[model samples]
Target: MEDRNNNNNEIYALIIGAGISGIVLARLLAEKNQKVLIIEKRNNIGGNCYDYIDKNGINIHKYGPHIFRTDNGKIWQFLSRFTAWHEYKHKVRAIIEGKEIPIPVNFTSIDTLFDTTKAKVFKEKLISKYGKNEKVPILELKKTDDKDLRELAAFIYEKVFYHYTLKQWDLKPEELAGDALARVPVYTSYYDGYFTEKYQAIPQNGYTKMFENILNHPNIKVQLNTDFKDLKNTKYKYLFYSGPIDEYFNYRLGALPYRSLNFEFKTLPQKQFQSVAVVNYTSKEPFTRITEFKHFFNQKIGQTTVAYEYPAAFELNKNERYYPIPKQENEQLYKKYLQLAEKEKNIYFIGRLGEYKYYSMQSAIAAIFELVKKIAT
Candidate 1:
C-alpha cells in the first residue's frame, strides 16, 4: 500500500473501483481540487459497459451490448464532455412461438400474433380499459377477470416472462419481486424502441474511449488490476468503495445473493445475423438472448460479431456479479450491510454492487452525483 509516486500530487481520496461510480466520484472530487487515486481490479475501465472494435473492424461489447439511455439531462450533459453522442435508438425483438415480435407487447405485436378479429378485440379491449398511450403493467394485466385479457396476459407470462425469468434469475416468476416483472411496460402503440427516455444514444467512440477521457485528468491517477484488499493498510482523507458491500465486510453476516451471466461471443463470416440489435429467446433455452453487435452503432462491416448470454448463479470466484438478486431475503441482507456502512465515518459506498441494487448506467452516475452533492456541502 505505497502512496502515489508523484510528490506534487497530494491525494485526498482513494477509490476502490474504476467503474462509473468510482470514476464519477474521482472526477467530482478532482474538480473540487482534491487529488484522487483510483484502484481497479480489472485491466481496463468502463466495467461491464466496455466495448471495442473487433478483429473484423466491427465494434463489439466484451460483456454484452449496452445502449446508453437516460432521461436525466444532467447525466447526459456530464457524459457529453467525454465523448460525442451517436443518435441511435435501440429496438429489441423477442422470438416466441417461432415468430419475432416487438417486446413490451405493443399493438403491432398483438396484431402480428393473433387473428384479425381476436387482435382487434384485444386492441379495443386494452384501449378501452387502460386508455390510449398507457403503459399497463403485466401484473395488472394478469389480474383482469375478462377471458380475452387474462388469456393475453397468460400468453405474455408464459411466452415472454416465464421461461426468460426462469433462465435469467434461476427463479420462478413468483419467487421474484412483483416490481421486477411489473416494470415491463406494455405499450399501446407501434413505438418500437426499447426505452421511452428523452435522451438515448451511444458514444461515437467506444465506452472504453469515453472512460479513458473521464480518467484523463491531471489530479486523477488510476491503478488498473489493483484490488481494494491490496490497499487495506493505506490511509487517505476518505475512501470510496464500489465493490460488493457484503464482500467489503468479509461476508461476516453471509454473502448477499446476486445473479451472474456468462457471455459467448462469436465472429461469423456474415454481414448480418439477426433482424435487430437484440433478439430475446423466450423459451426453455439455456441462453436467454443473443445480441448482434454491429446493429447497435450501425457499423458498416462485412463480418459481424454476436454474443450469447447465459444467466447463472453468482459464484464468488467463478463469475462476476451482474445483477443484485431482487428479493426480500437479499434486500434484508443488504440493509444489514448498509447499517454497518452507516457507522463508518468517512467511507462512501456507491454503484450497483456497493448499494446492492439494480441500476441503469444513468442511475449509477446519478447515485454518484447525489453523493458528491452531500460531500460538497
Candidate 2:
C-alpha cells in the first residue's frame, strides 16, 4: 500500500463506506474547509440505512427498518440540518402463541394476553418471587436453587426468548451470549414505546435523501461501487475506513465474528399492513421481525411495502454484515486487530463494523462527532 499526504489545499481526507458515519464525518471535514472524497462499495450511498423505491414504486428500506432515536441533543440537532423530521414514534409487537402482544412484554400486554385476574396474581407472585432485583437474567432464574423459580424461568424462556432467538439467528438460547437476553428490557409498566430516547423520528423523505444532502457540499466528492482494496495503492492524506476492520487488515490475525442479515421484501395491496412499524415474531417463525415502511414514513397509499428480516451468522461471500458478535472469543480477536490498527498511521476506523461493536444510528453519529474532533484537533 502506498501512502501519500496531499499538500495541496484540496482533498484533505479520503473516506470509505459512505454510511451515516462516513457521510457525517465528511460533512464535518467539509465544514472545516477540508476537501473530502467518499468511496462506497455499493452502487448507492447511505450504507445500511439506505431506502429506495422497489419494483412496485413503494419506498422500502433495502436493509431493514432503521428508526432514528437518540437522547443526545447535539446529534438530533445536527441531523436536523440534513432533512425535515417526520414525527414517528416506533412501536413493536410480538406474536406469541397465535396472540399479538406488545413488545418489551409490558404490563398491558400481560393483562391483555392472559386472564386479567391471573395476570395480576402472576405479577405479584413474580415481584414476591424476584424481589427488588431491577434487572435479572431470565436464564439465571433457571439455575437458581429454587425449583419453582427454575420452572418459571424455563416457561418464560421457552415461550418468550428461546424460539424468537432461534428464528431470528438460527441459534438456540444457549448458543447465544447471556448479555443478549440482558439487552432486552422487561418493563412492568404500560409503556409500549420501543425506545426511550428523548428524540425519535424518521427522515421526512427517506434516509438516502438526508445523506445526499449531507454529502452534497462542494468540498466532498463521492465515488460509488468502489471498494477500499481497490484504493489501497491510491494516494490520500488520510484514510477513514468504515467497513469491516478485519477485512481491511486482510484478516492478518483472524476474522472478527459478525452477524449478518437477510431481508425478504414484499409488497401488499393495501394502505397499511401491520398495526405498527415493526412486529416481532417471538414464536417459531422463519423470520425474526416484519417491518412496514409506510408506518415509518406516515404515507397514505393504496399499496404498502414490508420486509421480513432474518439474522444469521456472517458468511464471507454472502450476507451483508449486521451485528458484531460480542463474545469473549470475538473480543479477544478484535483486540489483536486493534493492536495492528494502532501501528497503521493515517488510517482511522469509524462506525459499527470498523470498530467491531454494535452501535445504533444515534451512536454511530455520536462516534462521528467525536472522531471529527479528534482528527481536527
Tens digits of per-residue lDDT, candidate 1, 1-377, equal 22334455456799989878888788888777778999999998877788888788778888788888988999999999999988988888998788889987899899889999999999899988888888888878999988999999899888898899899988898899748886677887778888889998989988889988988898888999888887766657788999999999999899999899999998888889999999999898899999998887787778888999999999999999999998998899889999999999888888998899888889899998998888776
lDDT of 2: 0.80
The lDDT, on a scale of 0 to 1, for candidate 1 is: 0.87
Stretches of candidate 1 exceeding 4 Å from the true structure: 1-9
User: What do the candidate models score in CA lDDT, each in turn?
Assistant: 0.87, 0.80
The positional error of residue 20 in candidate 2, measured at the CA in angstroms, is 0.8
Alpha carbon deviation, residue 332, candidate 2 (Å): 0.8
The per-residue C-alpha lDDT of model 2 at residue 123 equals 61
Each model's TM-score?
A: 0.96, 0.89
Q: Which candidate's TM-score is highest?
A: 1
Tell me the lDDT of model 1 at 197: 91
